[model samples]
Target: MIDNEPHKTKAYIAGVNLNDPNFDYYMTELANLTEANNMEVVGQSRQNTEQIVAGTYFGLGKINEIKSMAHGLKAKVLVLNDELSPVQIRNLEKLTKLRVIDRTELILEIFANRAKTKQAKLQVQLARLQYELPRLHPSENSLDQQRGNGGSTGGGFANRGAGESKLEMNRRTIDKQISAIKKELKKVANQEDIKSKRRNKKQIPKVALVGYTNAGKSTTMNGLLKEFTDESSDKEVFVKNMLFATLDTSVRRIDLNKNFSFILSDTVGFISKLPHNLVESFKATLQEAKDADLLINVVDASDPNMIQMIRTTQSVLREIGIKNIPMITAYNKADKTDRNYPQIEGNDILYSATDEKSIKLLAKLITKRVFANYKKFNLLLPLSDGKTLAYLHEHAQVMKESYENDGVHAEVRLAPENQERFKKYLV
Candidate 1:
């Protein structure tokens, strides 16, 4: 019988430590990223150095040691913990005889693989092209060949007529593609902007869920939607126990009751040292968070690296220009820990997203924080003022309402803006 198991690329992950305290955690994350990209991490190496070698990332001796050890381990790819310069990548590949993939490229490849929506696809493609443009070299036209059309012919052909090498033509083509993708992206963004403007006009409070990848954000969203919204498969976002499972922003209206409703958005999760290009390209998708009135920073309480993960989320939020937004730290996965479930400490909640009681408590905490400024009002509207009564029902949290000879009498919680609108009806 012939053995026909599928082959997985054997990858050796390595990193140079400049005495950073988080070096080990970074290496662990690199290994996870490699696995997420469908490669098997076969072995690992690390070097402690005062400074990185400008031309080769690792010193010559370290590189030689890595080369020998990787060969012994049957590893065909060298995965680095940090992004490398193009020169460093080429030099390492030459020295080690293994294909070199740096941290940034590895992350971009994952995003490319995970992108499902057109906007996400275009964003990843734009970022990839931007990353590749400067890395393009004359000798690497073989890359184009590998993709297809190996010979110097077709559009990339050196127009023996123009003396442009296929390399230059390839660069030109990428530039054109980048421009075209940007134009299309802008059009899509404009459409999103229109919808966003409409949502803004409603003046509903917006809350965004942001956290580290695989931290159970999508699960939390599903829980909220299930409990607070009409339960439907379409209302649920994708949930999986994997990195980067969600690439697009999902926005839903969360109706807590007849009295309280707010817009909720779940955004792409953050990772440590995410590729700069990826972050830049996904800014549009993160707009929901940037525009939010409050943010629920969900965290994996069971993870040992919880503190670092929290910092990573904060760093990414700042990079995206989100500032001074009120945030509640939601420590999820409390079931995996000995701590109490659905416990609130100040503005933070420790809970499991899957537990119904925990979800309810989380919702209560969110409602309390997001609606803290709302004021209670008692109003009486005349029978002819049915429109005013309807407005109160739609905009304010109507706590109590009854039909009377005067018209309609109600007690409601009114947001600051609506407080002014209903002042004339106050009793």
Candidate 2:
């Protein structure tokens, strides 16, 4: 921690591999992350090396240059946009005389602040421990003192009645902590299983909002919910603007119309270059997307890389084992687009989410998509049998209704599974 209350400090990027096209984007996101954490970027340095030094990540010349720059700017923090090995971290700290952190640590810190639910906090702690385990290499400064005194080959304590490496003990401790965290998560997963079973029994059609981070997903959700419910009573609908905003799943019951309605679920956002381990840990949270009946893959219309973001979103979806779900692309932020947006493959629907016409079109498109799979039915019920008519109207979308001499005649479209409920009136 800085002695002076963490003033926004200048920093720069180092150890960049230029062969990868995504390197620039990753560095840009790193800048964004730093800004999010209340830091300022004074400069950035890039290198074309494939293998970083085992000690200092940058070459000795580059390290000396960095040292001078840090002293010149009085930079308190050196943010490396890549995961540095423990030795590299130690070397950088000694050379720069500043707190050195990698992308993993930076992300975990952001997660630490954003985590709201019990499960999210646990997962963040797990990731943090895993990251800190390696970097927490016991003070070699003390180890050097022990070595100077000729206590053992290495500076620190030993194991099994013999001098063992300090690194070995640290590794063992990390392994133990990882196992314990996994056990705790297993218990949480069991509770999730029970909750999922209950939701299945209710058989409510689920629509999940999924997209890349900072892609206005939460904004879209707030707009959609605000359109459906009055502002005073829509307190349950939560909206936030941050990386991984909406970490915990928020389920809202939306009334599509008088006859058909379903639940809309907003979930955690995805990011480019998201660590595989983090993705694995967030599987349970992402199960909401997997179980959704339909996915509104929200895209930022103004972003130039909408196609790449869409691909990344789909890749994450497939990683979580969700395929074959009907999807509608919700091209959000259309009002901000310079010109009218072009269409994408697979049932694309364009809307600003802030526009009244756009939101109505979205609702209509959702209804049409859901009803496309429904089986058409024409039934005539006796006038005396009010129970059956009410049941039909409640369970299925009754497109047309006519009063008949016998009772009422209704033409409706309903899912094949729901058709069984009205078998008695079929004629």
Candidate 3:
């Protein structure tokens, strides 16, 4: 078979740890991010310091050491854990003789590559422009040679292929682009808002799946789709074993039974140290979760770093201002471990999404939570009120119905407001 894979750029990862305890985990995330961006991490280096150097991130001695180590590894790119100023980036490149990329840029590049929808693409573009807005310098700097590099490493803040032209874009041009993207995104967000309002009008309890990247959110979504809905492949969202696999939020109505149903939405996964601009740009895309009556925070139960991953999800949730929402800690991928499958402990569960039994149990749990507020009612409407009969069948969960000569008898589950509206017809 012909080898069809393209060449992967060799990258050396490094970070300046300013006495933080989670530094090592952050570095591991950096390496994973590098690979996710289609690069190979050849090696890594870190500096534990009390204070960062003003000009460069790492001290001069450590910088020289990293440069030597990276050169020995035959790495073409030097990836850093923190976002650096333009001067520091230029200085690092000149000293290390490799293209420099920061953590923020790496994430943006991944998002830029993964964004497929119009709204998602525009959001990523908006974030990229905002990130570059400040980094762009009016005058020429030391990256003149980067212009000749031909973007072989793919387009990014650091790997900017055909580099100088993008760097040469003045602030005014970038500002205009930012404004245009914002205007377009606003229109799209308004459309999304309209759709959300319609869903709200249905009064279906909305449920959202949220978690760290590559944590099986899409797989769980597929499990629910296949179990509750038709097994048509077109209804399933994309599933992949990589970071940020599902960028666009997917909304589908999950009907557990005639009397119970909720709108389920699978959302974009979160990552550690996600760029602030990216979060702000994605707020509209994440509105489903914000409006959700319940959230399923999926976790990779088999991964060693599950705790940190959960923390990362919580952090991003907090950043997006989502608080007091009911959340279920869904520890997925139990088949990969030695533990028993489909066990619920308080508000959390240990289950595998691919198992039919597990999906049934999860659905049961969701129904219990989402329908907890519903009130059952018995009402008699006049035979002339066919519109009300149709409305009750469509909106309320009708458990019993009958036709009488003088009126229609119905026993249904209704929300609090619905309970009050039809009180006149109470039987």
The sequence of per-residue lDDT tens digits that candidate 1 reaches over residues 1-427 is 7878678999999999999999988998999999999899999999998999999999999999999999999999999999899999989999999999999999999999999999999999999999998887665554667877555444444444333465688899899999999999999999999999888766678999999999999999999999987764788999988789999999999989977888999879999999888899998999999999999999999999999999999999999899999999999999999998888998899999999999999999998998989999899889787687667766777789899997788898988888888888899
Q: Which of 2 and 3 is the better model by TM-score?
A: 3
lDDT of 1 at 320: 89
Error of 2 at 82 (Å): 1.9
Each prediction's number of clashing residue pairs: 0, 3, 1
Candidate 2 Cα outliers beyond 4 Å, as residue runs: 1-6, 134-180, 230-236, 340-346, 376-413, 417-425
Off by over 4 Å in 3: 1-3, 141-169, 382-395, 398-405, 416-421
Over the stretch 215-290, how does candidate 3's per-residue lDDT look in tens digits? 9999999999999886547889999999999998999999888778899999999989999999999999999999
* lDDT tens digits, residue span 237-259, model 2: 45555566667777776776665
Name the best candidate (by lDDT).
1
User: What would you estimate as the lDDT of candidate 1?
Assistant: 0.90
Worst 10 residues of 3 by lDDT: 137-146
Lowest summed lDDT across 10 adjacent residues in model 2 is found at 155-164
lDDT for predicted candidate 3 compared with the true structure: 0.89
What TM-score goes with each of the models?
Answer: 0.89, 0.79, 0.90
The TM-score, computed over Cα atoms with residue i paired to residue i, of candidate 3 is: 0.90
Predictions in order: lDDT: 0.90, 0.74, 0.89
Off by over 4 Å in 1: 1-5, 142-166, 378-412
